[model samples]
Target chain A: MTQNAAPPPKLILRFTIIGLVIAILATAFAYVGGWLDPGRLTPDRMINTLEDNAGVHEGYRRNHAKGYCVVGSFESNGNVDSLSRATVFETGRVSPLIGRLAIPGGDPHANDGMPPIRSFALQFQLPNDEQWRTAMNAMPVFPVSTPQAFWELLKASQPDSQSGKPDPAKMAAFFAGHPETKPFLAWAKTAQRSSSFVNVEYNSLDAFRFIDAGGTTHFVRWGLVPEAPFTPMTEAQKQDPDFLSRDLRERLDKGPQRWHLIVTVANPGDPTDDATLAWPADRRQIDAGIVTIDRAQDQADGPCRDINYDPLVLPDGIAGSDDPLLSARSAAYSESYNRRTREEAESATSSTQEPRS
Target chain B: MNPRTAGTFSLPARLLHWLMAIMILTMLFVGVGMVATVSERHVWLVQLHKPLGIAILALVIVRLLVRWRYGTPALPADLPPWQRAAAHLSHWALYALMLAMPLIGWTMLSAGGYPVTLFAGVTLPDLVSPSPTLYSALRFAHTWLALSLFALILLHLAAALYHALIRRDGVLASMTRSRKQP
Candidate 1:
């Protein structure tokens, strides 16, 4: 009878030891690598280091700097004399600014002139200030009024239910589910179809609070009216694809592209907490100062690409209202930025690996 | 004689296996790196992580199909039943995790109402709506699951080493592509 041969006890011992050693080594490595640590450092700090270090390497003072300064001055109805009548603070210098112009769509590379809203994020650094302030496409009101509505809107904007493209049905469902978005929808639809000329109008869809040196607070909606009137880009003009870029470039090449910053205050007695509601024209527009964009400059490749622009980066005087959208946006942007930079470093490492002989 | 470990894995299968191993390991490390970062620095990491997650997701699907079509070499007969079962179960879990992590991350990002950029400014749509509660829960889940995955990986490495150095059954040789015979 053929008997099964049993492995030697020594063999078993050896295997077990080997296994244990490997396990021990792996655990040690993991612990030293900080994998076992309860994520104390947090993702946001990592991103900030990446930006600051990268920014220095890129020859820029701040990672967000886009190489040009924008000074936005407010004017009251084209009347220089009326400027004094308004609460216009002459911001002598704003620096360390970052700007991103995006086509509003599910796809990042969606056509600039598509029938969708465009987003322009501007983050400016105030002198003698420690923080930054950001402005976006929508004015006082965000697309979603409440947290739940915001969630629904986000879900609706996801890739198509079937095709993985932006789903119109889903978008419609979102708007329908949150009727409060009706106001934003009206503006979104109009902005989507509107010509590039709309870019000239600085509309504040959100309401912000402006605190004075004396601790007095005023609810204000900020707007920008170009020295020139709105000139809608015709279909022919839009064909350039880089219509906005080209226009800005040309304007900058000639000289600084300047716009008047207008801040319309809420009625002194009646303060509006919600930015979604439009401020009455009778409230009177104040001349804040001019925002001028000088020649476009390029920073080091890294900073231009990796820096994040969170709207919550406000300075001392400009504090955020209890805008839930602003808070959500701040958190979301921080999370996303962290995730992306880590991936970049990994990919860069892998791509640069030397082949094992 | 047991019919397993008769020959090396096919070149294509071996290539895919190694490639996937490197990618997954990198992904795990990248994730750990991300969690370690502070929020101010996390922005850039988030931008790159999603695209890589999507890429890994795509690669995993392809790897699964390849494995199904071209079956992997069976375990050596010397491998105890428990070890064999453990290996199989661990591998399946890895596969499951490989898919789930990316999907969960994408969903989390979508729920946060942020566009997923693959790379080079290529933005994808949000997969879900932004909900603080949902995001908080998912973020917690993602972190915990990742820790569990790292543990499983350690076990896997241990098993492989056992077969290679202790059992001397050629398991590691099969994966390592050494010229040494069992």
Candidate 2:
């Protein structure tokens, strides 16, 4: 059966069949591949646009550009271990943590007392070799529900070159159209600026799922509730440019700052997908543990410098909820992290001098 | 046929072969998924991709040792020289692909200053310093190598099928079934 008897037409037919299949697969891949959605918002483009709007500060995080690192440990009281089988809750478990406290702005040297958003990002190393990383903001509620809306908010509030302020018309239209911003705006208008980062209650803003030993899934939002009393910053302190950083350093020098990790359990039909909505205050709150931050360090050489703090990095028994913004935020956080790290490396290479302490 | 050439593959050989087959297929899909989208799902996929690629790297080393020590069974005496040459070349190519893919992935991540965190506590030492230029180059290499590995797999499958079905040779059976011969 040497193919002298087999006609060339048969060979042609076989090639055509194979070619057809390849063409179809290539078309399918192109159609459903990464470029399928041509105008789809991409993480890189989102980050690039962010940098374009909020000018890049070399070696600094694009969003929370100004920050210092803190070292601490989270000691679980073992009460919530029954609710979730995570190792961090295994009775008296003291998991070491490194965290960053920051103001959410593009400028790293922005005034600390501008009534801007305060953020807390942390990484916990549990006994069982699993890690949990979370980033929380002091905002009572997120302004937008969807990631698209968040991007739109950034665009709408982009500062005018001449005035160095966002166009009032654009800002008004954005706020007027998005009713979800009402709660956040109302909170902002009357909210008291905290005396220090040690006293601010950092909220997760996104919901997450906690899986129990029994495999039951419970939706919850967790955050650090500072044990320090809610004292507003004095007018004189507000006038100081470095109040937040200075206050934290002075307070930590005396002793550790403490916060109770509170998990707010979601009730039946609670909104888990939208960060803009707040759950009822009466929802059962579980005091997961105590987070005592002892040492504050410059982010330049701190242990927390390298950590991405992506909110989706959860240990066993913990998982992300269906929040759309959570994914978008996590994606953007990585882009921010990558850019800053690369910039840091570049800066380190070009400079012959040791980095300033 | 030689009576004592070990017509069937040893249990260790068969187990590693099948295990690696499953792992490699999953690796391909995970690689695609991780790179395709910027959703939070990308995080999950990347986590899966890193450890799985390392596992393949570990097993491929063990597999090469096994190949050297035990060796593969001989092809049928009637098989063409071209098929025999192909069988020889494609095999080493597969092994080469397996070895290069993970090594490149690790190096690329290192170049990008990304940790190869297998678990919370387990991280592979970076093979290179954080260099964007190097990272971009290695990234392209890893992707093209993956596509080559994919094509090689399809070719390998076709050859195996031909031996199992068209030729009715025991080449495929030697790796699969425990029965040496009926």
Candidate 3:
């Protein structure tokens, strides 16, 4: 089998080329196959840990499992075209929106009042026929900066079975190790529980790079500031397991709920990569547009259920920043999406679409 | 009766070869774009991808039947034993991937519980049950196979060009439309 009628020219070159291809294949497999990766904390590992912490709810999002779908429209105010050439920012143009509002944690049946953080995920159908998706939270900043620290935080904060609360010593050690979590945790402790989802400001805590028509780059964090009166949840409303969903439906039934889309531009020195840090309050804030939600539906069968809502899913003018969490979230979210879509998810409550129960 | 010394490929064989070559290359680019992109732009690529894959699947099967009926031109006698063996193995790999890619993609999508929707809203039946772990494994396999397929194609192109240009042999032309005997 080794004999040949003639030997091909450049035998050394051919062997070298073969060796290089094999090397490239090995490296690629090492990356996707795990073990050879540096951090050992891969996206698959993160989701597995999450399932261990909070058992999986079939056919639902791994995080923020319980939520309702929203149908809305966003109107650009003509101010952002200079900063971002995205077609979504065409002056006076309105784009269709589908979104969701939910509390944090994997348990699909968690109480609305218990979780301090609320999440809003949006899918924007831009004027140019492209789509942009983002997952924002009500917190001004995140508790942990890196995915590794966040994973550790999840493990450390597991509640004691008997007491139904995390061990104080374990939390103390975690806080010391990750001092970055202190500020966000403090904010959570003092932040008032809003009675309605419309009253809260949903912040895209991770900054993104926006490229303008002139090829100028700006790092920006954005959020929706509600026009609705900032009201606290009433004691009676707190007793209802479905208060947030109930309140949202009731408000939308009467009229559209509105929020100003505020895009915050960062200064040259702003820490765009650190989720645990926030830029100064006086930084350039652009009143991008008004977001109006006209109606709501059950997430189970609604348009929003199938969407991944990946934060990194940006349009042409936007790109992900160097934040470690950006790639981390994208990977974990993809894994979560893959897992949930495969199951025949069942909504526990069907009578009232107010909440999936 | 030697295949290499025979006249060029038949009209139908030549047509199918070029047609499939365009399709398979487009499929590779589309597959790469589908995974790298995060925007809703990927939505269109994905929609284009499913139907393209189904088309290639159908064409490849027809291609095998055509080959069975008409037969291929044999390799040149003067070609080195190693080169001949390499050519044989790579061609086998190409056929294997052409069939396996669409099938694996269909199975992966099925395991992920996604509809194998094609043109005119025709959906293929699921080949397997929905299981997340199984879905992930299939996805991984599909990616590796595509990479391998892409690598093989590059090598195939290199070998064909070597015969056409450097070797000045008629091996490449045997597959082409030219009827002139070598």
Candidate 4:
């Protein structure tokens, strides 16, 4: 009688199976449409996509091409052990850090005063063969969540081949289909333009997991909170073509610039997968340590020039969350790294030939 | 029924009680610790926190089932009516918090466009659409719920201590001591 009475379990199981079938089919459809996974969006393809939007440079990265390298140290405050078991968090653990501060563009010679997003990337070497790497941007959130959407964003932003001008209709269509892009557009429209890279806060919008010694995990995103206040450029300061790089050089000459490494944790169920969604501002935060940049150099001759700063090269206690963008980034960075090196090789051969002639 | 012998709980009840006790305590500490840091460690703690919460949620379902199948022992005959009501209300509140907290967290993440990864390679389906406003409201609620759960846990612990140490009542033993043992 009881078995006959309760149909809910069987009903639920049937619906669960049906749901699974639908999900599998939907994923298959998205995959076939080339609108889900990043595997098809090869590094070369991504670079080419960016180049299509903005003409490419010969020997520079396809994006964030204009940059200056900095040598720095990350001083760990030892308050991190309870959250992650990484050696980078050991108190007083001083790690030599190399970073590049850059502005977003395909043009290596883009004017420094142009209003654009800034980027900061760091590689940290820890004891016991551990390493931590991250790439960050001044924007709080990226425009899209997936690699496919990123491609679409570039495509939409690209000038029509015939008209030689970006179509507003195409961008509007893209925004209509992908409403998530609206917040980013709103941010871009309203964001205060920072005058200098040192004063800008850079965020790792993708979420990551911090595993502690007891195997406890938390979802987190990090931001480099600049110690220098946001100093808007005067009209006179804006006239300098190399204002940012030049300002950083003069500032480093006087004293080391610093930023507090602030890591914000998502409460249980906080989004860890999407880069386009910014967590609520009041989420729990921790100022893990300080980053001090003592020296700056030209990107062409700098130690960081060859490094990819892949976010996936994580430490023992840290792991990338299921953020699809994280793996896409690693793939894209590798492509950028490889292409630049190959171009550098060709440029080197061409330069030597010129001297010989 | 003999009062002393009636103090024992069903074996499944006692086992689930102790297991859930440890899990809840660990989860509370882990939740607090997760909020306290933004270090590289916060990532792993987050990874650990999701699955642990889900496990607690899953176990609580079974626990509720077990509670229904094998009814709880009656309170001590001499216990005050108010005390008995408090005990009953607190137990249900803990169960509600345990169940609601994980579900709220899951829904919140769904709204925020984040996946609720149970652990490495396993992700649970999101329970809601991505909406920033909904995500914010849920996140705020999740924090307050956690704080509320924390307060209730302390009250429960204090009451348990009252029964075990001061009153010499066997109410605590109903869940703590196994029926199979002498």
Candidate that scores best on lDDT: 2
Q: Each candidate's fnat, in order?
A: 0.22, 0.11, 0.02, 0.00
Regions of candidate 4 where Cα sits further than 4 Å from its true position:
A1-39, A160-165, A349-357, B1-182
Model 2, global lDDT: 0.79
Against the native chain B, each candidate's TM-score is 0.86, 0.93, 0.93, 0.93
Q: Write the per-residue lDDT of candidate 1 for residues A1-357, one digit (tens) a residue.
A: 133444546776777687677667576657645667754443344334334323222112222222222333222233322222112243333344445544443232234565344444555543332334455552334565443355455445655446745578877777777777766667765553334422455555555677665566666666666665555567876676656555656666676555666777677654344444565668877765566555443322322244455665544445455544555455555655445444444444567642110
Instruction: Supply candidate 3's per-residue lDDT for A115.
Output: 83
For residues A229-318, could you state the per-residue lDDT of candidate 4 as single tens digits? 997766876788788888898889899999999989998877788888899989989989999999998887786766667787677788
Q: Which candidate leads the pack in DockQ? A: 2
The window of 10 residues in a row where model 1 chain A has the poorest summed lDDT is A55-64
Error of 1 at A194 (Å): 5.4
TM-score of 3: 0.69
Number of clashes found in candidate 2: 0
lDDT of 4 at B48: 74
Question: Where is model 2 more than 4 Å wrong at Cα?
Answer: A1-13, A20-33, A353-357, B1-26, B43-94, B100-182
Q: Whole-model Cα lDDT per candidate? A: 0.55, 0.79, 0.79, 0.76
Q: Write the per-residue lDDT of candidate 3 for residues A75-185, one digit (tens) a residue.
A: 998899899888788799898999998888888888888887788899897533356888999889999988778889888877777896778899889989988988798
Q: Write one digit per residue (lDDT tens) for candidate 2, span A1-357.
A: 222222233455555555565556445544433556666666766777677667878777777877899999999999788878778878899999989999887777888887457899989886443678899999879998987778788888787889987899999999999999999999888888888999989999999998889889999999899988989888999789889989999999899999999989999999999899999999999998899999999987777766677887777788788998877877787677766766665666778653221
Please give me the DockQ of candidate 1 compared with the native complex: 0.09
For residue A146, give model 2's deviation from the true position in Å.
2.2
Candidate numbers sorted by lDDT from highest down? 2, 3, 4, 1
Instruction: Report the Cα interface RMSD of each model, rounded to 1 decimal.
Output: 12.8, 7.0, 9.9, 21.7
